[model samples]
Target: MDPQLPAWRIAPEDDVAVALKPLETGETCLGVALRQPIPAGHKFALNALAEGSEVRRYRAPIGIATRPIAPGEHVHGHNLRTALSGELAYRFAAVAKATPVRDKGHRFDGYVRADGGVGTRNELWILPTVGCVGRLGERLAREAERRAGEALASGAIDGVHAFNHPFGCSQLGADLDGTAAVLAALAQNPNAGGVLLLGLGCESNQIDALMARIPADRHARIRAVRAQSEHDEFEAGLRAIGDLLAAMARDRRQPVPLSALRLGVKCGGSDAMSGLTANPLIGRMADAVTQAGGSAILTEIPEMFGAEKLLLERCENEDVFDRLTAMVNGFKRYFLAHGEPVSENPSPGNIAGGITTLEEKSLGAVQKGGVATVADVIGYGERTTRGGLTILEAPGNDAVSTTALAAAGATVTLFSTGRGTPLGSPVPTVKIASNAALATAKRNWIDFDAGTVLTDGIDAASDALLARIVAIASGERTRNETNDERAIGIWKRGVTL
Candidate 1:
């Protein structure tokens, strides 16, 4: 997009151009004079469109015209509707593997764990087994912070945090399975030098079950407490923390290859500029890391709807393509089973930001994955076992999805936003604003301004972003960390019995 222009068309085949700024009635753009006012970030037809004609953006169908749209008229939700209905079938049509960027030997100062994984931050984590003991975990974390104040001041560890989610109890089957799986994965994150597995004894998400889910090798670094069984749970937790901190004090940062790094790509509160700027900018960064032999994970399954084919075709093999196909249709079935339309997306906020349909949102959202070959299809809460691009099964909720990314082994997340938000992930979330206005308005929240891409161009913007991510991996605090915006959200599905 050219900020210098009054309006910009994203692709050659696009039938509409998004207003670079609010366009008044009778303004001339794209060889057509505007018939009505168009809000900046909103779209205007490039040519006449008959009812039911496909609306193209990013060289793909975003939706179809619900009614006749005259040239230069506003193209938005009022005139457009999603063409998607339900599950889709995908045939494996392999695309050439995208070449990785030239390896420049990118490295970051990180803590090397006994398991050979490197950590961007060495922190103590307190995880509650069930919602019943959530506050207990928080209290333990606070007291530990006070006890470890000197060590914290001396940088022995990053910080102590308690991730308390309200589902472990009264949950059955898959619900309990997901809760335990995520808790176990979080404990195993290289960032958590030590973990306090706090539990309320009588929950379906039992401490024993969670412990079993965690690898035996990781148990040495984890301290589990049955709050109900302990005489003084707080004191028990404090003692456990004391022991863990003492052991972690020996951990120190050392230079490691970029291959040890895992990057998670995400976007939230998107607007029209998201696809044009922030997302593609993040894509370049993802490609850089992957090219250097590092790993990258992309989630938000619902947002992959219309763009599934783009990702599916890039799969490394028939197995991956088949798995991805199942995952996509399964998510769509999840919506239908709940009696909701699959295209019931583009939240009011998305619509206000000029997104007309789920197709438009998905097309923009997948740009974060770049052109990397699809390495694998990972289940919810499962960690990425190999490097390259892994597609994770997750919803589009800001917190839940990002938390899933962190659990899936992302040490740092490059989060893109157009509408802007203060939400952060368990890992450091580097917020990239889609426009200059947003970056300026949320200076404290935004870590990078991809809006520069409008003038500076993508290659220049991407170079800066990759450098910023490397610095973050080397222990530089992101805006999210400095603002104390770190949080975790667990997805709740299945019955609560």
Candidate 2:
């Protein structure tokens, strides 16, 4: 690489190259003089282009030129428009092969659940069946934690937390079902050694109905109480949580293989370097875990528009391919149903960070899945059954998608961001920064810096990240966990009655 070239050409066929740093109008890079000043993380034309021509990034058509562009001219939303539209026919031309499982003897200390799942944390989780009782759950958790201070100090339990949300009531049909399903899955999350299900007696999301969804084997570790049935809801909740804390105290971490891991790969507050650095680094980790017989889930379905074909070809079989297709088209129809365009994405933050269109953002975002064959396609709030790369159906909202990943049974989530965010899921969310600058600037939010790929290279970064993940799985708290930045958001798609 030329030291003077402060830009990166992701692919030889790419018509634009990303500026690694600000370039003045007189400065020259890659033998091309700048037509205008280019901001860091933004793109510049590598070759002259005419109006209406295709603009390529990552060797894929990201958008179309709205007007004539000169060589080395800064390219952005002003002159570029997304070419994405309605769904098109897809064919399965398998490109990815089955990954070979290699046992490297890698292991992490985790809690072994009775259902054969492994938990990275041993905490008591208090889940509320209705939004009305969310505060009660929160109070119960605090009371339990305050009363069990000795247990917490003794390493008998990690902590007590109440995951509060606002959708259990005034919901009907799919909306109510979705709320119930997500709460049920969270209640069963392995990270929670024991669970207290607190409910308001009369609500659309009844505790009895939610309990039916949970597997029988997890019943021993879960306790349920209806507030309206109790003389004093707060006191009853506290007692229930106390019992859960006692049960959780008996849980301990044990060694488990990498195959037992379920990882969630995601990106948010992305920038130009996101695809170049952090995302791909997470992809390497995904490939490593999948190849070791573990599972990895890739969501943010709408972001997969321009690059859905690439993922389609990676489907393991016709069924999975069809499922993937349905998922994509289904989400597209959802956008249309709401009278919205399908390609309406690349949030304002993304544009300022050098991402011009959803296609460009997606081509980079999909890097989180690496090149592994997709083993399954799951709906919202569903758990992963088969190990490998699985695509989930969800929108591009960061908190919502991250929460879905956890509800779907991801023991840990690897979130790549160029612009930093303090957002986290119920599980440990490891934030990987795309550039060293963001990592340094937001030390509290960033967990790992993938920008080192430009200096130390990807292999070193991947190794370091893998080690960090193992440590996290072994109970080393991520910034989010330590800072108590945990929350959940359910995907609501129906009318509120």
Candidate 3:
């Protein structure tokens, strides 16, 4: 065995180990000679296996072998196939322990709302009740920003912004309700010190109905206008936003405990290095937040396929376990009902980055949740009511899930990526790159480099990352915020009519 080859076996029971660098035929690593060229971020079999044998990574079954695989052979999609199928019964084992609180006395400067919600950003938001007036809302926000230029300069307000989506009209049943709920949740988001709800008089998601969903205390900071009700819609919107700006100007930041922080953990465009570097680093941050008496949310249910057991066992109780199980199986049924398989993931980008199966992808993705005990399971568009690590029901789609995270009240989101994307949520979306190459290549998109974990050690990388997160919570702009890449996508589950 060559001691210098960069390879990692995640656990003692793992039969395959990941190659940290390219390996040529005949090169030896971990006592196995490579039978073929193995690319960096790909896996190599540590021992021979027959067809149909379980292929292990992360010390669990990732897939079944399609053909007889020799020791040292490259393991990838060409030979590995996912074994995930129909829903399986789950039993709570309570494997994870409570993360110990360190009481570091850490704090961040945040805006505290009247409802006692904390905000990392104090901005004015313009939410359109229908897609027909989305552009109008944007124009209104721009005009408000122009009028409130001096207030913005004086730190009385962060900025005037508008969120535009293609839904809100022509949606029925759950689709309409989902749109309304998400929009209302966004309106109540702590980051928005004040909000202006703009609407077209005839829409499924009416302004009045949306307002009814918002909490009473927030009404003082919220204003509404119906485009069809006003002769000059743009002028009316500008006037409403002017009032919102005046109220927002009264909001100010105060020293808030770390326990007030609600963090959203996400990953996208992941590569093999994702599991080894970035993901685990995020896990550490998750642990820190939970230990500090704060809350952290983990979503992207479909990506939790093979690794569901890991989280299910961490549930705080049987009820939480049952809810989590239902959430996992329910998503699987969603895929099957649509004539698709549960393992039909690990996108094209993922395969290129050496993720062979959904199981492999899942094991890596769940690391963002850390080792904290699961406290609650929240439905889509529902706000998080409990602290500690909570599981949220949402799709694995980048924009959709991140939007759900924001709606669930995450003031800041730590998004880990390996292949790279310019996607950002309405809140401050901190982009964590899995590799140094991607970090250097996309400096404008990446906010933190997890690749340093491979060289500097996880402890140092995690400490540095936590510091960066606290800085962001104190109103530092992430790369996404600086690049103006903010967007949102609501999950549509029913007929469009």
On the 0 to 100 scale, the lDDT of residue 83 in model 2 is 94
Off by over 4 Å in 2: 1-5, 98-103
Q: Candidate 2 lDDT, tens digit per residue, 1-497?
A: 23245999988999999998888997888778998999999999989889999999988999999999998899999999999888889887755785553456689999999999998889888888888888888888778888989988887798888888888988888888888888888877888899989889988888888889999999999999999999998888877777777778888888999988999999999999999999889988888889888899999999999999889888999999999999999999999989999988988899999999999999999999987889999998788888889998888898899988888889999999999999999899999999889999999998999988887888788888999999999988899988899888888888877
Off by over 4 Å in 1: none
Query: What pairs collide in candidate 1?
Result: none
| TM-scores for all predictions | 0.98, 0.98, 0.98
Candidate 3 weakest lDDT stretch, 10 residues? 1-10
Task: Report lDDT (CA) for all predictions.
Answer: 0.90, 0.89, 0.90
Candidate 1 has a TM-score of 0.98
RMSD of each: 1.1, 1.4, 1.7
- What does candidate 3's lDDT look like per residue over 339-432, in tens digits? 9989899999999999999999999999999999999999888888778999999999999999999999999999999899999998999999
Q: What lDDT does candidate 3 reach at residue 308?
A: 94
Model number with the top TM-score: 1
